[model samples]
Each structure stands twice: as C-alpha cells, then as structure tokens.
Target: MSEWVDVHFQALETCGKRARTAANMLTVEDVFQDSSAKQPADAAQASMFGDLSHSGALAGKVNDVWTALKEELGTGRSRLQGVEKAIDQVETNLRKATRAATV
Candidate 1:
C-alpha cells in the first residue's frame, strides 16, 4: 500500500511539472504571436492594408486565455503540494499502525 501511494505521488508530480511547462509555453506563444505583423508584398497591396483592430482584439482575448491557464496551473501545483503532505502523514500513520499490530 505504501508503495502504491508513492507511485501515485510520483504521477501527481509529473502532472504538476507538465502543467507548469504548458503554462510557460503559453506565455512564449503569446509573445511570438503578438510580435507577428502581416506585411504587404507590393505597393498595391500596401495601399490595400486591411483594418487590424480586430486582430489586436483577438490577441487580447488570447492573452486573457493564457492568463487563465496560468492561474489554473498555479492552482494545480498547490493541490499537488497539499497531496504530497497528506501522503506523508498517511505513511506515518500506516507505520504506527503496523508497529501496533506487531506488538
């Protein structure tokens, strides 16, 4: 049972790491996407530049999404930390219980 509990905590740790990595990736993606600007290839196309207000708004929306994801990732990390503490307590209790049974 203790071994199984250890395995579960390992899985949780991996999940937490993945969540942090994904959150970091989202930040990088937003930076790259924001820096992107569509340019016309020729004089005629330059004169026909389309309105980019919508693009700006869309980018804002995406940034908002990234912010939300980061918040969720933080929450997940906190939960994993709590679970790890709980697992330690459980293992301690199991040790005591085993000792009592042997006595």
Candidate 2:
C-alpha cells in the first residue's frame, strides 16, 4: 500500500507539471484571442484540475503562466523600443535633409 501511495504521489506531481503547461499555453492563447493588444492573465485551473480541487496546484500553475507572460512581454517591449529608435532616426535624417539632397 505504501509503495502504491508513492506511485500515486509521483503521478500527481506529473499531473501538476502537465497542468501547469496547459494553463500557461491557454494564457498565451487567450492573450492573442481576447485582447490582441494586451497580455492576458494566467490560468489557474482546467477541467481536470477543477475536478481534483487542488487549489495549491491551480495557483502554482497560474504563477508559472504569469512568469512566462512577463518574460514574453519583456521581449516584445525590447523589440518595440528598437523599432521606435529606428523610426526616430529616420525622422531626424529626413528633417535634416538639405535642398541639394532632395533635388
């Protein structure tokens, strides 16, 4: 019985890991689907997870999702900053253009 209990525990941990992954993916998907302009919050539960009622596991999954989203937002912001800088340079160069250059 004890051995079986350990096996069950391992199974639960695996389930938890998979659940976390699904929740994270759902979160990103929602971001794209719901509000294409803003990042979405993490998922705290799924159909199976709700049945298990493991609130801790649910919250943990949400945290994992949130962290992943935060990372993605950071990357996106970095890229946007680069593009903005490029645009600014182009505008400055255009404004500074001489009549001779334009002709």
| Best TM-score among the predictions, by candidate number | 1
Tens-digit lDDT track of model 2 for 1-103:
2466456556555655554444444434455765547553445545535666776777778779788876886566555555555655554454456334656
Candidate 2, 77: how far from true, in Å?
2.0
Model 1 TM-score on a 0 to 1 scale: 0.47
The per-model lDDT (C-alpha) reads 0.57, 0.57
Candidate 2 lowest-lDDT run of ten: 19-28
What residue pairs clash in candidate 1, if any at all? none
Model 2 bad stretches (over 4 Å) = 1-57, 99-103
After TM-score superposition, the amount by which residue 34's alpha carbon in candidate 1 deviates from its true location, in angstroms, is 22
Estimate the lDDT of model 1.
Answer: 0.57
